[model samples]
Target: MSSPIRLYMSMSLDGYIAGPDDRPGQQLGRAGGRLFNWLDGRKSGGPSGQVYREAPATGTVISGWRTFKLAGRRQGDHHDGVPILVLTHYGDEGGDGDVPPGHARFVTDVEDCARQARAAAGDRPVMVQGAGAVRAVLRAGQIDEMEIHLIPVLLADGRRLFDHLGPDHIELDLVRRLEVRDVTHLRYRVRRPGEAA
Candidate 1:
């Protein structure tokens, strides 16, 4: 096993990951896409811009179906070194456009997702992209790290930093913190089941 997995997400200061409308491909914003303006990606940068200015070299990217669809993906897109993985339950297959030319895999089982993510990750890190999906990974104790970009806005209600999970606790050690372009980056170790205190 290659050291579990990690979650990297952009969250509002109030902890809502996405606004309440919550439809595939429409979870964030209109033409401007202000939700992800902090992250150095297409919404924030032009086609030939710096998407990796603050991002680290991770090998795998995992996200929920909603996050995957809403966050427009370009085939062969690479940030630092991470490819993308979209999670789904076997029976919940909705229709989609042609598969992009990147390494996007649809895995039904969480364990299978973990295994595949680890394989894709190799020795590098995994950037867990959204809230509900990261919740699943954290609940299964499959995550190793979490990178959250703390934005300043606060939405009253929306998709949250965590979704419906059974009784659980997410206590992590603060690995690093930095404020860039007014956004705070928080890194944490997803404390394993029987790991050190």
Candidate 2:
């Protein structure tokens, strides 16, 4: 069988996943989205942005409809190079996401999205992107691993990254915590239902 879904994202010290007022032109900046800089070290040849550049060259990258739309409208069609999956109630308009070098598809359900991604990814990796959308996968227990680039900055009030799904928690172990320049990159493995203590 294929591997479980993997969620990659970052968080702040205050717990605000994104900048609070998420209006157009007033996005994560004022809402404490500075945390993205943690992964900023990954510039063209730098460290922080390397995770994004070296992520196994997957078949597709999945995101929420909002994120996809926002990136599409704001960035003006630049969705990395892999195919993208946007989960939302809105229909796939094709113009809402980046013009991928691979492909792009809009999906509604999580399972169908994963199946399609697995097929497209082949032996490569599938990136479950966007902080808000990743919480859904985590809540559903569909995520198997995580690669979080822990930055130093903090947001006073941004988007909250948690799902508030009962009191249950996903167990994780530190696979690596490397300090790249001024930023820190952390890797973790989600513990299964009945693993070890």
Q: Could you tell me every candidate's TM-score relative to the true structure? A: 0.76, 0.79
Task: State which candidate has the highest TM-score.
Answer: 2
How well is each residue in 1-197 modelled by candidate 2, as lDDT tens digits? 57446776767655565677776565564745566665445565655556767665655677876676556432432345556776665555544444422355667777777777777667666778766568766776777778776656666666766647458877898887767655577888889878884
Candidate 1 residue-wise lDDT, 1-197, digit = tens: 58447676777888777777776556563322445776454344532123334345677877776666666643435564366667766323423644444666666677777888888878876767767678777777788877777777877677777767668666789988766564677778767666786
TM-score of 1: 0.76
Each prediction's whole-model lDDT (CA): 0.66, 0.65
Which TM-score value belongs to model 2? 0.79
